[model samples]
Target: MSKYESVYIARQDFSTAQVEALNEKLNETLVGLGATVAKTEYWGLRSLTYRVKKNRKGHYTLFQIDADKDAIAEYERQMRFNEDVLRQMTVKVDAFEEEQSAILRNRDERGSRGPRRSGPRQ
Candidate 1:
């Protein structure tokens, strides 16, 4: 079995519960294929740099999977056939990071900075 990191964006129109259901489904699918899902993260709905499938925002999710190539291929195939999934990408990784993804970390940093000041050039 090889390690892989997969990130997927669900259509913004779906409710949080619906998104979670999709996540659960993905987990079940992978496990059924004899894979171990090490970690899963829901990054929440976020703005996209560009519109995708008429959506300007999407619910982001990540998965750290240890599985065979056939299992990974099956997972990708399922994602592609699912209409709620706006976009998905899977990449082979040497190891999975223990910390939150950069997007979530950036969100935390922005929140800690407090409100932005108006009229710069102080």
Candidate 2:
């Protein structure tokens, strides 16, 4: 099976729990198809550069999986038929990266930075 990285944007109105459930359903589909899901990350709600399905914001979710071509095709088909999903993309990758996605890494870096201080005159 080949490695693949996939992302889907859900309608902005969905709560976090709803988003989780959607991903779980997709994961189950992959598993049922004899595919392995490596990582599933929720990137949180984010503003879109442009509207999609009349939505200005969306909940972003990422999936990294090892699966055959047929499995990946089925996954995309599922995404298209899902009413809650706004957009989805999947790409074939030579290998999976062990590190967290850049989006999550950037979030962690921002959190790790200390808060700004002010009103100090030397």
Candidate 3:
């Protein structure tokens, strides 16, 4: 088995319900392939550094998984064929070092800022 991370962008026109459904289906597919999904994160709609499919923004989702090479190949193939997915990329990783990097960054930011408060317009 190999550790991997996949990041995908979905079309911007999907309704909130459709987006949620897509995420659910993707998770199911990964589990069905016998992959252990370590974590899944939604980066939310963000502007593309460059236009993709003539859209300036798209919704992003990230998945960290452990599976064999064949499983990863199949996952990428399915993603390409899925109409909801605009783009996807998968990369192998030696371990979960990226997770530790994220934790460290979060800790550094916390030390520099106090808890944020939300309020209505004054």
Candidate 4:
């Protein structure tokens, strides 16, 4: 089996619980196809650089998978056909990283900064 990182943005209108249910369904489908999901992360709803399907923000989720090409293809196909999925991407990786993804890590790091000050420099 090869390693892959799959990320998707669910429609912003969906509740967190609904997004989580979608993740569970996808995981079950992958497992049924003989794939193993090593990690799952919900990055919560985040703003997009540009509008997608009329959505300004979306619920981000990531899955680290160890599976064959066929399984990956099937998973992508399913996601493509799902109405709630705003966008999805899958990348083949040499290996999975055990640590949290950069997005999540950066969120923590950014939390320490005080609120931004907006004014002309004195």
Candidate 3 or 2, higher lDDT: 2
Q: For model 2, where is the 10-residue window of minimal lDDT?
A: 113-122
Every candidate's lDDT: 0.95, 0.95, 0.83, 0.96
Candidate 2 Cα misplacement greater than 4 A, ranges? 117-122
Tens digit of lDDT per residue, candidate 3, span 29-120?
A: 98899888888777668788998888888888788899999888888999989977888999999876555346346757777897677888
Error of 4 at 44 (Å): 1.1
Best first by TM-score, ranked: 2, 4, 1, 3
Best first by lDDT, ranked: 4, 1, 2, 3
- Per-candidate TM equals 0.91, 0.92, 0.77, 0.91
The residue-by-residue lDDT of candidate 2 on 1-122, one tens digit each, is 99999999999999999999999999999999989999999999999999998999999999999999999998899889999999999999998889889999999999999987788878
Winning candidate number (lDDT): 4
TM-score of structure candidate 3: 0.77
Tens digits of per-residue lDDT for model 1 on 1-122? 99999999999999999999999999999999999999999999999999999999999999999999999999999999999999999999999899988978998998999788789676
Question: Candidate 2 lDDT (Cα, whole model)?
Answer: 0.95
Q: Cα lDDT for residue 73, model 2?
A: 95
**Taking the tens digit of each residue's C-alpha lDDT, what string does model 4 give over 1-122?**
99999999999999998998999999999999999999999999999999999999999999999999999999999999999999999999998898999999999899989899999979
User: Scored by Cα lDDT, where does model 4 land?
Assistant: 0.96
Candidate 3: segments with Cα more than 4 A from true spot: 97-122
Candidate 1, poorest ten consecutive residues by summed lDDT? 113-122
